[model samples]
Target chain A: MLELEIAHNWPGFQLQLHLTIGAELIVLFGRSGAGKSLTLRAVAGLFHPASGRIILNGRVLLDTRSGINVPPQARRVGYVPQGYALFPHLTVFENVAYGLRSSSKEVHHRVMEWLDRVGLADLAGRRPHQLSGGQQQRVALARALAIQPDVLLLDEPLSALDAPTRSELQALIRTLQRQLNIPVLFVTHQLAEAVLLADRIAVLEGGRLLQVGLPKDVLHRPARPEVAHLVGVRNLLRGQVRGISPEGLRVWIGEREIRAHWDPAAPPPPAGADLLVCIRAERIALVRPDRLPPPERENLMEGEIIRESDYGLSQVLLFRVYGPRLTPERDYDLEIEIPPYVYERLGLDRIRRWTIAIRPESVHGIPCG
Target chain B: MDWFPLLLSAQVATLATAINLLLGIAVGWLLARRSFPIRDLVGALVTIPLVLPPTVLGYYLLVALGRTSPIGQALEALGVPLVFTWRGAVVAAAVSSLPLMIQSCRAAFEGVDPELEQVARTLGRSEWEVFWTITLPLAWRGILAGMILSFARALGDFGATLMVAGNIPGRTQTLAIAVYDAVQANDPTRAGILVALLSIFGILTLVAAQQLGRRLAA
Candidate 1:
């Protein structure tokens, strides 16, 4: 377990992050300059914070109030910085041997063992420059793990690799973390990468942690508008709860009232409360105009196609919801995405007008940040 | 021609380069990695010898280390009077060549990625270990070129060595001063030999620098 509460003041940005990471992989997910890397560096003792306390596996690494701060050399934390930063002059064997300072033979054996574990034992004689990018990254990981740290910190380590190599190292990291059973804090801006590797996701924006939860929870039920946007929610509509009935909660989007679900796991808000609804583009389905009408519990809106685009595997359609009343506050232009097969099966490419059906449970209400 | 002056000049250059190697790397690393209130001032001071006329620098050293000055008196009491001695020539050469050493070293150290050092620290190596095992090995090629440049500069120093060491024959007369003396004595042949040797030394040092740089780059 690792607990970090740090407030750092840079020239133009201030980072105030409070997070507790369990022994699972916790990915610090955010855009560039979102303070994810800064948080990792602070935990590694490379960046000093103005105030905070950091505890790693019951060890107090830093406590500003008590003036207790451990240097990076004493922190005993494994850090794989961006670019791998392998010592260009050292061979892979020597690079891995850097952290092992005991008996020479024992160190050599351990270094070779780690090299073999990372599938670089044969290339231990080669320098970092002689290896491919993925090989160098594995060597860096081997060197960091040779120290046997209690916490592992990785800063976009796979961002520079090709797709195949990136996924290969991703699996290697998962296996290593599972075998070690140590808390790993990985940083990345790629949403797909985070979803694939993160046991829990912590969303950082503007130097603060906006939300932290399982990948499914954060993706389907983001707590804030910014997080909803970061997590790839394209259709965020401002709505007010009109009433709660046996069917579901009714929300007013523009002039049209739509039925949305209030998750039973979450506390129900009062009626007439203002909230923002997040519906992922993929969740909204398109129905042909001539098809049989669906149940009234589902949100059915008639809209004209304003824009459409194809991204190989799926087609994105932009639609404007049509209503009799025109309210300046209502932006009913909804963005919907359907897989290529769905696009072909529904003959979506043949029409300009269609009805989009949004399930009540799919429309998630996120309180404004 | 007596070979003693040439040998003495080589010896002085070697010793001066050695001293500059240590002083330059220390000051250069400090300047490259740290920011203090007087950092710019210290940088300018280190660069003074590079821009100052060699004769002016020699005069400044003479004034500071002359017999009547307090520092000179202290050194004399310590049995290390510097004026009119071969050691004075070495001191003159080192002062003149220090800026080259320091500038090259600073650039080299700055070129090194600090992230590498940070990673080394997180790997449980102390600052000293990181410097030796990571920083020095990575930057040594540039540092070597700097040392060679400083040695060549020291070898060719004339005005400063002539003033402080007084151009004594076979004792304090380095190759540069010997060439000047040969020119004054109307001995073009002797001057030609000494000048050719200095030029060849400079060319060879430059060649070595380029080769080392290429090898390290590869």
Candidate 2:
């Protein structure tokens, strides 16, 4: 297990993170300059955090209050920085054996073992410049693992590879992490990569960790509108809580009323309090206007299809309330997504209007912050 | 033509190059990897030899190491006299050639990616190990070229060496000083031979430096 809570101030970006990781793969997902790489560097002891404690496997790597900061060499964390940082002068075998200098007798054996594990044993004699990008990545991983660290930190290792090679290495990294059972902290801005490899994902923005949870929870139930936007949810509507009950809250978006669920453990906002409602584009089901309206009191919106876009496997439809005044602050437009098959079967291209069914359970209420 | 100056020049240049090699690398690494309030001032001080007239530098050294000075008195008490001797030639040559050595070495050290050192540390290697195994190897090409340049520069140094060591036959007279003395004595043959040798050596070192620099860049 690895736990870190650090706050560092930079010129343009401040890094404020509080996180914990188990033996599973956890991805730090964020945009450029979001402090993902900085966080990884801090944990690896390359960058110092102003205040916080980092504990790895019950060892205190850093504690600012006690003025204890372990050097990078003593931290025992394997860090594969971006670009692999392979020694250009060293061969693959020597690179992997670099950290094994203490165990001189078994250095070669251990290095070969790791190279074989990464399926690069034959290329160990080649220098880093002679290998392809993916091959170099494998060599870097082999070198990092040779130290037998308690945790592995990878920084955008796949960002430099081609699409096919990236996916291949992504799967390889995931399999290696599980087989080794070492806590791994992977950093990337690509959400798809995070979703594919991470058992849990931590979302960051502007140097702050916005949310951290299982892939499904963070994707479907973001804690804020910004988190929802980053995770690709497009139908975020500003609303006010008109009524509250033990079951859910009734929110008013313009002239429409939508029911949203709030975690019961946390006290729900009082009635008439401002809030934000997040409905995923895919979750807003499209129902024919002539069909029977969803049971009474359910969340529904009747809107005209203003635009449509084809995205190969799926299609997106932009729907706006039929008779509402469109203003910069209160435009009641919701983006809905449907499969290409549904779009073709329903002849959505020819349809001018859509009745989107916003399921009560799908409408997530986020605090208006 | 007396051949003794040739041997003395070779010895002085060799010793000076060795001394410059150590001091150059130390100072170069310090400049490349550290930042302090006086860093710019220290850098300028190291580079003063590149721009200062050789005789002016020798004048300062002469004043500082004169018989009445504390350092010269201590050395004289220890039976090691520097003024008007071959050892003074070594000091003069080394000081005049130090800037070239340091510039090349500093550039080489700066060319090494810092990330490599960081990764080495994460791999459990101490700073010293990282320097020996990674930094020194990667920067060797530039350092080798720098050492050769310093050697060539020391071999041809005339003004500073003449000021401190004086033109003494079979002892302090380096190749450059010998050429001057031979010309003054109206012996064109001796001056031509000495000048030709220095020229050939200078060309060879320049070629080697260019080749090594190209390889380092590649």
Candidate 3:
């Protein structure tokens, strides 16, 4: 387990955070300059914050009030910085052997063991520049893990690889992470990678953490407007609350009432509170002309596809609703996404007018100023 | 065919290079890795010798280590006086050659990626270990080149050695001073021999440094 609370005042960004990680992979997801890498460095003891307390497995690594700050050498945390930062002069075998403090015999054994673990045993004699980027990344991973550190911190490790190699390493990382019971913190800006690797996703923006929850929850129900945008929430509409109950919130959006999910743990918003309604592009489904309406309470609206972009496997369509339009000034109200096969099967190219259903559970709302 | 001056020059240049090898690397690494309030001032001070006239630098050294000075008196009491002595020539040569040595070492150390050293530290190596294992190995070629530059500079130094060590043929007179002595005495053969040797040696060191620098770049 790794727990850290850090507060730092920098020129443009102020870092304030309190987080705990158990024996699981937690992905720190954010946009560029959102402090994801900085947070990982802080945990690795490479970056120092003005005030913070970092505790790993009951051992205090940093406590500002008590003035206890451990040097990185003794912290025993594995850190693979962005680009791997592998020593250019060292061979792959030597790089992995670097962190091991055992006798020569034991070091050689452990080094070769980790090399095999990362599937690089045969490339041990090769230098970093001689190998591919993915191969170098594996060497970096083996080097960090060979130390048997209590925690592992990876910063954008796979961001520089080809798609095939990236997915290959992603599976390798997930499998390897499961074998080690230490807290692992991974940082990435790509949401798909985060969803694939993380057991929990922590959304961060502008030096602050917006929310932390399971991948599905963070993707479907972001807690803030910035997070909604970062996680690619397709439609964010200005709305006013009409009513609230155990059922959900009935919010008015541009001359129409749309139902949105409301958490029961918090007090319900007043009937007239302003809100930002978040609906995902993938959650809005097209209704075939021959089929009946979607299940109960799922919003039904008539909209015509205005513009479309073909993304090979998935197709995105701009949807503009009929009478009492959501946005009268614009040509589109909501953006919807469906696979290409579905588009052809539904004959969406031939039929521009369509009915779309938005399940109330998929539409989330955040209180607005 | 007097060999004393030749031998003395070799000893003085060799000893000066040794001192510079140690002092240059330390200062170079510090200058490259650290940022302090007086950083620019310190950098300028070290490079001043490269631009200053040798005679002017010799004048400062003479006063700083003259018999009337505290350091000179302290050394005198310790039975190793420097004024008009061979040791004074070593000091003069070292002062003049130091800047080249420092610049070479500074550039070499600065060329090394700091992230390599940081990663070494995170790998459980102490700062001292990292310097030996990572920094020194990576920077040795440049440092060796600097040492050679300093040795050549020290070997050819004439104005500063004359200003401080003075011309005493059997004692402090070095190769450069002896050449001057030969010319003053109208001994063309002696001056020609000494000049040929010094010029050849200076050319060889420069060539060797060029080759080493090329290899370092590659």
Top TM-score model: 1
TM-score per candidate, in order? Answer: 0.96, 0.95, 0.96
Task: Give per-residue CA lDDT, model 3, range B1-218, as digits (tens).
Answer: 89999999999999999999988998898899899899889899999998999999999988989999999999999999887899999999998999999999999999888878877877888989889888898898999999999999999999899988999989999999999999999999999999999999999999999999998898
Off by over 4 Å in 3: A245-247
Stronger candidate by DockQ (1 vs 3): 1
Top DockQ hit: 1
Each model's backbone clash number: 0, 0, 0
Specify the poorest-scoring 10-residue window by lDDT in model 1 chain A.
A323-332
TM-score of 2: 0.95
Model 3 lDDT, residue A95, Cα: 95
Cand. 1 Cα-lDDT: 0.90
* Model 1 collision count: 0
Question: Against the true two-chain complex, what DockQ does each candidate achieve?
Answer: 0.90, 0.87, 0.66
What value does the lDDT take at residue A105 in candidate 1? 92
Superposed model 2: Cα runs more than 4 Å off: A102-105, A245-247, A289-293, A296-298, A310-314, A324-332, A339-341
